[model samples]
Target: MSSTPPPLPPHALDRLRAAVRLREAGDAESARSELLALSGTYPRDPGLAYQTAWAHDVLGREAAAVPFYETALAGADALGAEDRHGVYLGLGSTYRVLGRYAEAVATLEAGLAAHPGDGALTVFLAMARHNTGAHHEAMSALLTLLADTSGDPGVRAFRKAIAFYAEDLDRVETGD
Candidate 1:
């Protein structure tokens, strides 16, 4: 028996694409409706679950999105890398906005462990840390990300200094 999951039926794929298009066209409500309907028919589809969660998120329904995101992530082996990454970010960010800071930190940390050096994930992780009162870690993460990714010439010039300070923001240096 083939270990690979069977490909989605053509009609299902078309419906999924149409739902995504609705979302992109600024009709998130319609998208959510379509995705929810499709999810009823394709209850085990990881991709569908992910899209349903995204639609809920775009509609400012973070709590409603959590179970769908969890379902998608639980079936991670069936999802593409990009979808997996989105699940982690979406779930983590949703948790943060919902005041579930510890869950956000755990989710984002797990994502970073799996997809290291991702700027978006790092940024969200920093936000989660800040919410959890890990101010030092949050600032350090933001500073490091800024130093590594900022395009401003001035920032580039001071990258080394920023990195050094990121390691120890409260450091005091005295000339002897």
Candidate 2:
């Protein structure tokens, strides 16, 4: 029952769309640079901050992206429901990449609580749990995802990811 967020001004939307295109083209640095340049005009725009953080995340600058993600989230009310919920996944993933498993778990768990049906959040939570040696819980979540043989590509991808992690766990357990 979330209402749609108000539309961005034409100029802002155009810039954001161009930034997205840059990202899709695998030019994260360009996208980040563009977004940063647009920051002054759309200073408090959550979408701009999110794109900036997303670009940094894609460039593997977890430390650099963290603050921007936090900034975007701090002004989350400025975003639509979709963006508000999606930011957690990126932030949680950045935390995981930084080896901050506790923070990752906390961020992902909170997101999962808010969006109970988000498979992405569930998978991330499982990943964080696995990193923390909560192998059983991780396996439980993977198994649940694996049960969804619905032929949806996204579900298939999640299953494959779960399998990859499960294999790692098995190898570790077997000392191989």
Best by lDDT: 1
Cα lDDT tens digits, model 2, 1-176, are 44433456898889889998999999989998888888766666678888888998888888988887877877777777788787888899899989999999999998887788688888999999999999888887766667454476776767766566655545554465
- TM-score for each candidate, following the candidate numbering: 0.93, 0.74
Task: Return the top candidate by TM-score.
Answer: 1
- For each candidate in the order shown, give its overall lDDT on alpha carbons: 0.93, 0.81
Clashing pairs in model 2, backbone N/Cα/C closer than 3 A: none
Clashes of 2: 0
Lowest lDDT block of 10, candidate 1: 1-10
Clashes of each: 0, 0
lDDT of 1 at 46: 80
Q: Which ranges of candidate 2 are over 4 A from the true structure?
A: 1-10, 40-43, 149-176
